[model samples]
Target: MVFEYILKQNGIHPQNDLTIDQSIDFGSTAAAFAGGNGDFTVEFEPGATSLESEQKGYVVASLGKDSGYIPYTAFCAKKSYLKENTDLIQRFTSALQKGMDYVQTHSPKEIAEIIQPQFPENDLKTIQTIVTRYYEQGTWKADLIFEKESFELLQDILLDAGELEKRVPYEDLVTTTFAKKAVK
Candidate 1:
């Protein structure tokens, strides 16, 4: 949704302006690009770096950077479940805030070292580069609050993509109480 949204924002019509071969699987997109399948490919992390390192493609644009604040990692629960589990939800949001705070305070190299075990195949530099890119792009929001503007923008994207039949009001779906309390 964001990729096509970004394309539209850049004055390029996704379906009319160019060919988008989404037939390629998610994980195989970078590989397909490396194999010379498309002129451009949208990738995350290792895939983007791998493409650049292998000289297959250059990282020209950032969909996230231009897309604005998106709740890339979000927690969802039924209203009843949330009302019943307020304490648990608060703790979870608080923990997420702590991690976000850590990222905001620490350097990319330090973060890379801490998470190195998760990606043993990738070197410290690669992890650092990816972290640096995310940092530079302001990928991590200061707080976990999915604000009104962002929510609406995301809805707009979904609507444009025909994934949503009607706009869902922000108040109807989102509650920033936990996130706000966590930030406090």
Candidate 2:
């Protein structure tokens, strides 16, 4: 929800004029293929006005009231490998930063063109909707200000999920050095 916080901090209301909703199904490969075509015969439609008793259609609904949140998994890197190949980590991070920059600067139509082919079933409109929402304000901000409120919210969610034993202090978990350099 870092995006939400950035917008809110700048007086952009995510909840007031606009509504927040997740995809019909969380990262469904099949649904992605059938996007907005009403072709799934099973997948829900985009912004569906009403539900039918028995018919192939889509459903527009709140992300909440869903069964469970997506789980967070950790991938550990071998300490020896990391220590010997620090450059690999740096390169990967740099590449990601460059990609985020490209996405931010490109027009939505341009971005849409690049993404459309991946999901042949999804009309350009559906892909556009997803891209606009995810990359809304632009740059993924690899070095953007590490807003404590955002992390705190994440920690709270994890705690509620019984994933965290005790909350860590902001200083222990995040650093602002990169963000400080970014604005300069």
Candidate 3:
């Protein structure tokens, strides 16, 4: 959807000029593009970075850097669950904020070494590359607040893609009350 949004911004409608071939996952998409299965495919890091490093695939654009602060990931829960587990949510957010802070202050190589246990299959160099790219791009946020402008950009993309019939107000969908409390 983001790639489609970017294409529209560049005045290239996927429906008219480009053939959109859907892939099951990012790695497969990168592999397909690298193998000449498609001219282009949208890939997220570390898959995108990995493809360029290992497969000689060229990156035409970076969605994160180019799109200007689109919030692609979020820690979400059901309304009922959230209502009941507010404290737990706050603790989780606080811990995440601390982790984000650590990443922001520390070197990407150090952060990668700390996280390498979770990704045993990937080598240190690949992990370092991915972490460095994300860190440099400001992909991770220390604050949990869902920025209204970023949310609106996501909504606009969805609306343009016909996934959303109407614009959903930010207040209705997101609450920063717990995040605010967590930050403090």
For every candidate, C-alpha RMSD to the true structure in Å: 1.0, 9.9, 1.9
- Best by the lDDT measure: 1
On residues 92-139, what C-alpha lDDT tens digit does candidate 1 reach at each position?
999989998999999989988998899998999899989999988888
For 44-113, candidate 3 gives per-residue lDDT tens digits of 7667777788865866767877777787678778899999998898888888778877887899999999
lDDT of 2 by residue, 1-184 (tens): 4334444645768679465454446446334434443332222233221122223344432222121222122123565765776667556545545665677678777787897988787778776765664454332443445577756766765665467888999776565443344344
Ranking of candidates on TM-score, top first:
1, 3, 2
User: Clashes in candidate 1: how many?
Assistant: 0
Q: Please, what is the TM-score per model?
A: 0.96, 0.49, 0.89
Ten contiguous residues with the weakest lDDT in model 3: 22-31
Please give the range of 10 consecutive residues that has the lowest summed lDDT in model 1: 66-75
Candidate 2, after superposition: displacement of residue 39 in Å?
23
Which 10-residue span in candidate 2 carries the lowest summed lDDT?
65-74
